[model samples]
Target: MSGFLPYGRQTIDASDVEAVVEALQSDYLTTGPTVARFEEAFAQFVGVRYAVAVANGTAALHTAYAALGIGPGDEVIVPAMTFAATANAACYLGAKPVFADVECDTLLLDHNVLDPLVTERTKAIVAVDYAGQPCAYPALRAFADRHGLALVADACHALGGSLNGRRVGSLADLSTFSLHPVKPMTTGEGGVITTDDPDLAERMRVFRNHGITTDHRQREQAGTWHYDMVGLGFNYRLSDLQCALGLSQLARLPVWVERRRELAARYIGLLAGLPDVRPLEVRPGVGHGWHLMVVRLIGACPPGFRDVVLAGLRARGIGANVHYKPVHLHAYYREHLGTHPGLVPVSEDAFARILTLPLFPAMGDDDVDRIVGALEEVLEDVR
Candidate 1:
């Protein structure tokens, strides 16, 4: 309570510490039984047949794109509101990323705006569950079916969410997750990809391990040291130590998600008093995981009002931040992909007003109250 409250952070417990210590004490630290154990647990949690763990989320994205055969000349439509990694992964696979606009209210990819960007060369749709809210998957799935394009989910922000009783990982052909410290859970640094197709699962597994057909443990057990590099790949393996942490964190995911939801509701209730603050519109039947608590400023708030609020909150030991600046507006994308400001109008406008407040399981009622009080004071000064 005395220190700065960050916008997002991992909540580690004694059990998490014990699990990591146990992994360190084990005979194997990396590419061992623990990795498979964590993957199995995660797959079950996500209601998927297979889950491949990797070094990090970006690696998971790259592996998913590579496994799906997305390469040069192929286009993958993604929302401009998401982290750059969602599109950068396509670029890594030599594919062209066609940036798409997000809906003004939800800050999620707008298929109405996205469908026009599709072309004969479009190979996939990388639907990101921005801010932990599941995308419009039912519609997106039908569109992918019509176009014969792969549907992948950048679901790092939505590990515990669902849409119409279907879990996030099972919603798409291939769904990717992150284990960064600030996410719903942490493994120090790791990621996982989920898919029901065995072929895609195998391809992603090989893609994470330098295209090697079999892991070292498999060769060692066979007593025959023969392995082949079947396809192009990289060393994206997550260590047993990290997997141990992930498994421990997974056990607490449900409670953590519920806590986030409660905190989000409280923020909504509190922000309602401030007429100019507006929470994102959550569509019906969508199970939001609440990775971030974002609110848009309304009612003729000054042009740089969000910036003033951020500076004011920072000065008061509250670490508020913006979820994103539209990906296409970034310098690299503008220079390399010929993207411009007006490419996605709604997202660009949202970026200017959006402000992310702290929301994590570790925070209690007092924390929320403090953040709200700080924000109210900042908003008053801005007004």
Candidate 2:
């Protein structure tokens, strides 16, 4: 506990290390059996028919959008509160990302706010499960259906989360997940796309491998070197070494998510004493994966107060951070997309006050207490 605690981190055990070592010792480092095994296990875990592993989360989003046939002039609706990658992926495919406001309490994509953003050119809606609570998928799904638009879930923060009984990966037309070290599970640097449609799955598989009809493994199995590049794609393949680690880590996901929830509950109880600091609301029937322990500074706390709190906590070795600044507010989006302040007021307001406190599966209840205690002291000092 000597070092500064991070807001989120990977929790790897000896088994994870062993898995990677075994993968390294194997004949295939990439495009091999281990990758297929991880994909199958992940799909089954999330109640989806297919999962295609890729280089990373952004690649997953890019592949998902491409699979849905989103292209130039296509507009994709996405919440402003999410990571820039959510919107940037759409940009990668020459699709415009139309920013939608998030719900105040949850920082989740507000389906109600999406109506005004939809246009004739709207090709899809990307629902971001901000801070690991699944978005209002039922509403979003229904909305997408009415508009004949594809629904994609930017579920990088919500690998193990669910709404009702349906898992995050199974909640949309195509769901993308990050397997970054800080995510629910780690593959060092990797991502996967989940879908019930076989066609979409195949598209993503091809998309990750330079749009080639056959991979080296397939060519080797068939005893032929012939292949065809059907479409332009990126070399976004996830290696077998990472997949081996992911498979090991995926096995412990349920337990890790449970621990995260337990830590979140502990944070809630401890922060009750801090009247100005309020935890984000968890919607009913949602099983949050709690990738971030985000809280809002409500009551009399004004804009810039969150930064003060962040500074104070860092001085005390509590690694408090902010989840995001709204993507639309970023410089690139403002210049290119004509986005400006007041575009999504709710998200703008939340961005100013929200703070992400340390929360990881390896953290103890005492860690939650320490973080809350530090937050309390920071608030008191600011006053």
Candidate 3:
């Protein structure tokens, strides 16, 4: 009650600290064995054959786009509701991003809208797992296969999330994850690209580190410093120190996900009868990571109701916030793509009413109660 409860936060413990400390004390801090080890562990955990650690999620997306041969004149279909990186990756390749509206309830790309969008230039579909719930991969896969297009899952918010017992990363041709402090796990601003395709994985590996064919560790094992610059690439490698932290964090991922699920259930039960507020729908067969507990304000709410609720939560020492505005509504997209307000009605509608409340592993029943109490007060005052 005294301190500000954040919308999301990293739950670091002694093991995480020790991992960082050990890395700091070790010989290699940057581009070292730890990064590879972390990648291997992550790949195994996600049921993927390979994983490439990078500087951040945006870099992961860019690398994946480049690796899959998406470039000038190509088009990638992306959900309008996701983070900009899902579409910006295509821009990085000098390709255009074709925006598709999301499902009304799940806020994920509607596969029904996708096929019509695919043209002669369409190269891939970047399906985002919005709010930690996996997209309908089976349907997406079928569509991608019919068009001979790649399927990339921008799973930055869904590391521990899955569908029908199949992990998120393994479901797509390539999957990317973010390790920012507020995500399901943290590596203090790091990311990893997972894939079953060895060639694509190798491409991402080289691309993440200045297009170098062999990394420092590989050179050391071969007793030579010589390496080849395979192609044009960016300096997007994750440090060993970050990977060390990630490895420790990965060990706690299961419990963290479970706790998040519990918290989400508590919110559902608490707000069940509330008329003006509704939780986002989670489709059956998918395990939501609950990275953000988003609730939508319903009919007849004041125009400034969201802001009022946010201010009231802050006043009560809670850190509630909105996830995002529709990506196509941003200035750059409007100017470049000529995207307008009605382009993605579902995403635009969700943006107007959605609020992300505090939901982290560190929260307890008291925290949950505090948030609910504050929300109730704000709703009544605004109504």
- Itemize residue pairs with steric clashes in candidate 2: none
For model 2 the local lDDT of residue 343 reads 93
Evaluation by TM-score, superior candidate among 1 and 3: 1
Q: Each candidate: what lDDT?
A: 0.91, 0.92, 0.90
- Stretches off by above 4 angstroms in model 3 are none
Pairs that collide, model 3 = none
Q: Determine which window of 10 residues in candidate 2 has minimal summed lDDT.
A: 298-307
lDDT of each residue in 79-99, candidate 1, tens digit only: 899999999999998889998
TM-score, every prediction: 0.98, 0.99, 0.97
lDDT of 2 by residue, 1-383 (tens): 55799888999889999999999999999999999999999999999999999999999999999999999999999889999999999999899999999899999898887888889999999999999999999998899999999999999999889999898899999999999999999999999999999999999999999999889999999999899999999999999999999999999999999999999999998888889889999999999989999999986657677788899999999888888999999999999989999999999988888999999998988888788888888888997
lDDT of 1: 0.91
User: Which prediction has the highest lDDT against the true structure?
Assistant: 2
Ranked candidates, highest TM-score first: 2, 1, 3
lDDT: worst 10-residue window of model 3: 300-309
TM-score of 3: 0.97
Name the runs in model 1 displaced over 4 angstroms.
301-303
lDDT for 42 (candidate 3): 99
